[model samples]
Target: MFDIKSFFKREVEKKLIDVDDYIFMPERVEMELEGGLLNCVLNSDGRVDIFYSKEGVTEVSSASRKHPFTSFETELNHGVYDDVIDDLIKEVSKIIDGSSKYFRRNKVLPSTAALPSKPPTDL
Candidate 1:
């Protein structure tokens, strides 16, 4: 007497366990996507911190300070895994397409010093 439904459920659970293991790895996983770099770090509360930088920066501190693109936190489980992944892709695409409001640029202020009346001619 083989229970087909139970068998399939067990198989799916096994696959999910493997994915969970990878997500829980001590080292962060990184990849390049749409002219930017994406980083995933596992947090202690079973959530992942995802960061995107358009400058191709891998360091989180540098990216946050210089070119902060987009960042979010997500908890992935078997039930909502697909939905979460799809939403992540869409968000990243928005950032690359320059349509996301999260995109930011560092502003440089012009100097306020007065200019000289005559130009110095020193050859």
Candidate 2:
């Protein structure tokens, strides 16, 4: 009974950005967030894999295609949807705040601080 459209309408839209309907799996739901795809994949094992990705940066790909992903898991039962959503929000915040390893490697640092000590001395 996990309906993507219903979930977005009831759960995500006002709290998060209003994403266009783009559900990909019968057991999963997804939306565009912070230039990436925010996914909730409901596994047969009764766990949900919440993830974010910037690899397939397109609405169509985010909707219908596959790409490499980074994720964390959560329980799918009980009335813990709020807890799960909170954890997901924390994870996204960590990535955005540049505290996560993925963010360190993937994000472009605005400062020259991380650059090597030597620069091209010629012309």
Candidate 3:
């Protein structure tokens, strides 16, 4: 059986993060076949924002905004469902890579629901 919880745990283990790390989001977040609403969540100590509708969770394509992944997106380099939680880890890695500036300047540290909370300092 495809257990979301177990799969998530496995992914975290694969990523080699502390259990206290920020809980970013879900595995197959925003599965288009499943209406792409993205079963999203945030820090381990925060609340999830569930977007619902009368019908149910709906598909959410990338809004036409200046997304962080502009390079990948503009070039159509990203695979499908690449913006959802676990999938977006690469985006987080990018931030971590350039932590010094964007992380604090943009004020995007891991929030409460963030799993395996991010380190206060990345040095």
Candidate 4:
């Protein structure tokens, strides 16, 4: 018997771990770019949202569902569910890669804020 709830839980956890690898910060991972700021978050609903902020406002946003596995029928095939999760992982990987690259190119360090300048030597 296929345990849909257990399968979903396992797949979601796996995907979250994969996503966390790209996120160097807590819930909100952010980067600064010439265009603006890029932010991503793993939502409670098992969806990931990417936002682009310019001039202190979000200009663009995109979302992807973590559970790509599932069927309309009450009963689902185990193999099919596995395949869906695989696909979901691949799609999320691309998003993570893209976000990481953007941060790298922009020279933004996640989970870090610029520190104050050193005081004068004379002080």
Q: Give each model's whole-structure lDDT.
A: 0.48, 0.48, 0.37, 0.48
Residue range 1-123, candidate 1, lDDT tens digits = 999999999997776654334323333656765666666665533455556666433323211111111122232222223344345566656655564355446645568989989898894
Better of 2 and 4 by TM-score: 2
Question: How would the candidate models be sorted by TM-score, starting from the highest?
Answer: 1, 2, 4, 3
C-alpha root-mean-square deviation, candidate 2: 17.5
- How many Å off is the CA of 28 in candidate 1? 0.7
True-structure lDDT of candidate 1: 0.48
> Model 1: what TM-score?
0.34
Return the TM-score for each candidate structure: 0.34, 0.32, 0.17, 0.29
TM-score of 3: 0.17
In the range 60-119, model 4's lDDT, one tens digit per residue, is: 343543333332121122332334434444454456445543546558556878676986
Q: Rank the candidates by lDDT, best first.
A: 1, 4, 2, 3
| Candidate no. 2 TM-score | 0.32
Candidate 4 whole-model C-alpha lDDT, 0 to 1: 0.48
Best by TM-score: 1
Per-residue alpha-carbon lDDT of model 3 for 1-123, expressed as tens digits? 779999998986766544333443321222232223334322233233323121232322232222222332232235432344333443334444454534466576676764666766777
